[model samples]
Target chain A: MATRAPKTKRGTARRETLLRSAERVIGEKGFAAASIADITRDCGAALGTFYIYFTSKEDVFRELVGMMGSLTRRMMTEAVQDAPNRLEAERLGLRAFLAFVAERPSLYRIVEEARFVDPDAYRAYFTGFASAYATHLEKAVAKGDIRPGDAEVRAWALMGMAKSLGDRFVMAAEKPDLDRVTDEAFAMIRDGLAPGGAA
Target chain B: MATRAPKTKRGTARRETLLRSAERVIGEKGFAAASIADITRDCGAALGTFYIYFTSKEDVFRELVGMMGSLTRRMMTEAVQDAPNRLEAERLGLRAFLAFVAERPSLYRIVEEARFVDPDAYRAYFTGFASAYATHLEKAVAKGDIRPGDAEVRAWALMGMAKSLGDRFVMAAEKPDLDRVTDEAFAMIRDGLAPGGAA
Candidate 1:
């Protein structure tokens, strides 16, 4: 299922261009309706150019899911790099997530579409994210930045919150207030796990 | 697009069969790839019989989403019917949601597919749920069963957590512990909004 990675600089650019085309075409038209020709035409590349880099439409779609995972992780990392603690990181990270959704709504759609188009890729995307996110939470707890709890459950729960908020506030809203939504959602995240929570 | 509700007892049964077939076909192959013939063939009915109930494939798909929405709401209502308080209801509701996902993975897939296949239906599903869910939270806040917070945000956030948990712990799990997952998740939901959370 691995697409042939480009070797030369020009080849690398061609592959990236094709992947971008797939994201737009597949994301908009969906995996079943979107065709390789539509992706190639959008890429400004000949039909045969697609074959040189990827084996099939499914191949390119899988690559797109994988690429989206990497891109989202990089974006989240860069967005929260300077946070003083995990709690603050949670705030910055959520704001970053919502803002990213605003900027790359298609990426969000692509990852979701991967659930049907490529279930393995979809599972890997969230599972991998949850795994790493849980580790981050574990360390935060060890350092007393956050309260002790099951990081695995918290990781998935927090990811779910961000995703739902993005869908409701950003993807679905006409003009969403990113800061306000983040503040409201982060309020729950902070106090939800804060030590000595009242009954 | 609306499917014609059955007028007679036999018509109703036939329509139900078609809807079941549509769920199986569309959930497996997706909306674009799934055809009327595929649904009818799966239903063991002639192709022409499909139009007797559903206007088209799109009609039946829309009906399936509606049906799933009703079914989920019913399940959740039944699950939380006897809860002593909102806190207990939250625990029961989350567990019920995870169990529903496990029982009917196809329903989850169909609803998600609706997001792209029928944007209006997708919006209606979440928007309607969030609207009702917000009301529920508002009542709980008024009763002092939970801390005061933005009902709209909590509704979406809690829904997100349930959805994400269902995906990770039920739909994708090789073997999942419904009780343990529910307890861990309910813990966060409980403490996150608990009054007087420590800074």
Candidate 2:
């Protein structure tokens, strides 16, 4: 579906409203169950107004997934921008990621659901993230800020760790403690589970 | 959907065939797109015969998810049974998981799809596995087999690592090298990425 870019400020604001509403509705009801009418209704817009911004439900869902990808990348970048080193960056990045999941859980679930709703977009999201992550690891290795290993493997492994921790601690927890979870996971990431471990 | 257990040997065999077929059909086409007729057709069973064991497509999908949970637990247990220490068990277990993903990519996708199709089953499956994993970590900590940390957090983090690695290396890769992926990730899980890392 072809999504049109709004020309005027009002149109831009209206499109943003529809996108936000679509995120909430699609995130709650999922892609298959959520309807265009539901999205418009949720945003207090007429049914035809949805067509002004998006062509179909699939188009809006894909846009949401794309939005999530860029949002996550931007969040992580800003979160870790001031980290002193690669290891600190990992800690900062993981903490930021968990907090992001806690704050915008609807968008998180929507991105996950994209695995089935839009497989290509889903693959692109993670693949793009992983590639950028691998580059960072490579830089960290060159600087000797962290141990040398397979950057690609390490990047994916760390991403997995953060993703799982976010799901368990933030998404699934009754009372999420971002600080405690971040500290423990960061400890493991830095020193690992090796015997006579570093504190 | 209420699924009936097969009482006779022939009934059990037939049920198993239907289940195996369901795993493939659902895994390939996904739960929403896959139908009972496709499952029956794949298994060479009559349309009416599906009702012999499973009441509906949802029933069969749930059964497959359940089967994956038990099968994974069994596989992990057997894979790590002979490990001399917790660290070794981690390596063996990860290696086994990647191999399992490569062997049964269908069932792997099926379990993931369960997250949406049957939310309760999906939660139960991961919660059960994470609990068992946490227990193992507790034991390992008590034995001084690895450095002590939050068992639950570690369990989920490690599970996430293995899962993401499986997705990237085994599921997404056209040419997967389970041993190398296992080795690299195991190194991180063991010694971490601290400067002057122990390899």
For this target, which candidate reaches the highest DockQ against the unseen true structure? 2
DockQ of each: 0.50, 0.83
**lDDT by residue (tens digit), candidate 2, B55-137:** 88888888889999999999999999999999999999999999999999999998888878899999899999999999999
Candidate 1, residues B143-180, lDDT tens digits: the string is 87777678899899999999999888887789999998
> In terms of docking quality, how is candidate 2 classified?
high
lDDT of 2 at A30: 83
Give the TM-score of chain A, superposed on the true chain A, for all candidates in the order listed: 0.93, 0.98
lDDT of 2 by residue, A1-199 (tens): 6798999999999999999999999888888889999999998999999898888888998999999999999999999999999999999999999999999999999988888889999999999999999999999989999888899999889888898898889988999999999999988899888888465
Q: List the residue pairs that clash in candidate 2.
A: none
> How many angstroms is residue A91 displaced in model 2 relative to the true structure, after the best TM-score fit?
0.4
Which portions of model 2 show Cα errors greater than 4 Å? none
For lDDT, the strongest prediction is 2
Question: What fraction of the genuine interface contacts, i.e. the true contacts, does candidate 1 reproduce?
Answer: 0.60
